[model samples]
Target: MRKKTNSAIRRWMYAMAYTAVSAVVLAGCGNGGNEPAAGDGKLTVTATTGMIADAAAEVGGEHAEVTGLMGSGVDPHLYKASQGDIKKLDNADIIFYNGLHLEGKMAEMFEKMEDKKPTVAVARDLPESALRTDPSGAHDPHIWFDVENWISATEVIRDTFIEKDPANEGDYRAQADAYIAELKKLDDYAAEQIASIPEASRVLVTAHDAFGYFGDAYGIKVMGLQGISTASEYGSKDVSALRDFLVQNQIKAVFVESSVPKKSIEAVIEGASKMGHEVAIGGELFSDALGKAGTSEGTYIGMVKHNVDTIVSALK
Candidate 1:
């Protein structure tokens, strides 16, 4: 586990204690509860990442008000929850997060919140066979890179919504079906686009190992300077190694992630240039987060499409 700063540890402790007390107070209230607390009559959903938030909003439709804790370019692996985030989780009818330690710093807090509300790790229930294991045999948490995996996550959200708000079961199911259909289309599009690149050039090198599932599903070889989680640091040796691999493989372009610093990839590019093999920054890919709101890449589908398009344009 990543070590938390003292201030972060203190904040987490305070949030946990505060939520425990709030849960008790809520349970003790005489009012027959378990219903939406929002005056707008929508289930208040707090999700850890933008992708999970998008899934909740799509599945919950008009019956849910979703808030994402981490926004574009925010790295969840290193993200620590704030007091305001604790309030959001405490007030939410349901809390959704990508499991498998993606939110490594906030995992303990989420576990504690489960006693108070329906705190769910949307990717927690995915089959073990579908996940990619790191060197330490830990499951990679960036399942959103694979459209099929995300489709499963969307269904998990739908089922949870139906269970918590049975009155909206039909709406949740119908909306999820529609959204899943769109994801199916996305999966097909990714396969087709990625297949267009020459097999020899079908290698994806990124700032981190967030695309194992993407490469597995779409037939591309993936390499990353950093480990599965961004919490794992890459050293000068790592950069030099990746630089050598890019040169030997004759890879023209390597991608950067929106949530990670560009310096690591820039170093690789420079090293490759020094070796007389130029490597271009393909484009920024949305790995742990999506694009800014209101932009095409802001939505989950848009994000996946943007990644596929960028990869194809650069390498094809």
Candidate 2:
């Protein structure tokens, strides 16, 4: 069962209000007056997620200094901007976010920052035809799971840097091209690894619907006990249903996310066990965030590789 629904909602509302008021007050305090000149030093970039921060750093190379607001094991869906985060957003020369309501509570804050600086939603401009929608028609915001989609996001970051700091356009172009090539290779690696999994075992069950894009990209079936956003709640019924699905499909394992609590999946496992189906917990996957900084799973490419390797090892 989910926890703290009412408290979480209240916190989100308070944060949203605070962000809106802070943006207005900060706007009046000459927050955007200190725009960094081209070649002035390093461009200051603030990104909402580690994935975007990784892309900004890779594409910007030595020409930019990037800070990710959400770190390892942080869930953006329920994230509320702190006063410190507000200061960072106010001071950054440019900001990049996943958008598509992934950072739902921070929407107004980003909207307010648009006039102050270059606030780009990397995933917002992806062709709608390439996006997946929930039953209520909301586009899924976890586009980073699809390496091909993330390549487009990398291009968006690269283009933003070029436009903002034309003095280093050549460097940005080169860095972005190299990174995109790596992403293409990563995508191929995921496809090949997933293909190795036995057809009957090519199923991915997780704490939430975060891997829809991964399943779509790799030709695997995915089931989640919760909805796309971690803010969405699940009940005993949902767990029972997922347990039934696993037993009927004879799935060997269900993965846990680094950012989500493990108890939900554990409940499903317990339920399955009661019905005589034995299921194991696959290795943790980096879902809403990356691994600890400086680790193999810290970078975007490394995170995708880690997830793919874990899935294949467990399900194959």
Clashes of each: 0, 0
Residue-level lDDT tens digits of model 1 in 1-316: 3456877998899878877865654463221245655588898889999999998999999999999999999999999877678677767888899999999968887787666667889997689899999989999998998899999899899988887888878999999999999999999999999999999999999999999999999999999999999889899999999999999989999999999999989999999999999999899899999999999899999999999999999998
Off by over 4 Å in 1: 1-34
Error of 1 at 145 (Å): 0.9
Cα-based lDDT for every prediction: 0.89, 0.90
lDDT of 2 by residue, 63-132 (tens): 8889999999999999988878887776678889999999987887788767767889998669999899
TM-score of candidate 2 relative to the true fold = 0.91
**Per-model TM values vs. the true structure:** 0.91, 0.91
**Per-residue error at 188 for model 2, in Å?**
0.7
For model 1, how big is the CA root-mean-square deviation?
4.6
Clashing pairs in 1: none
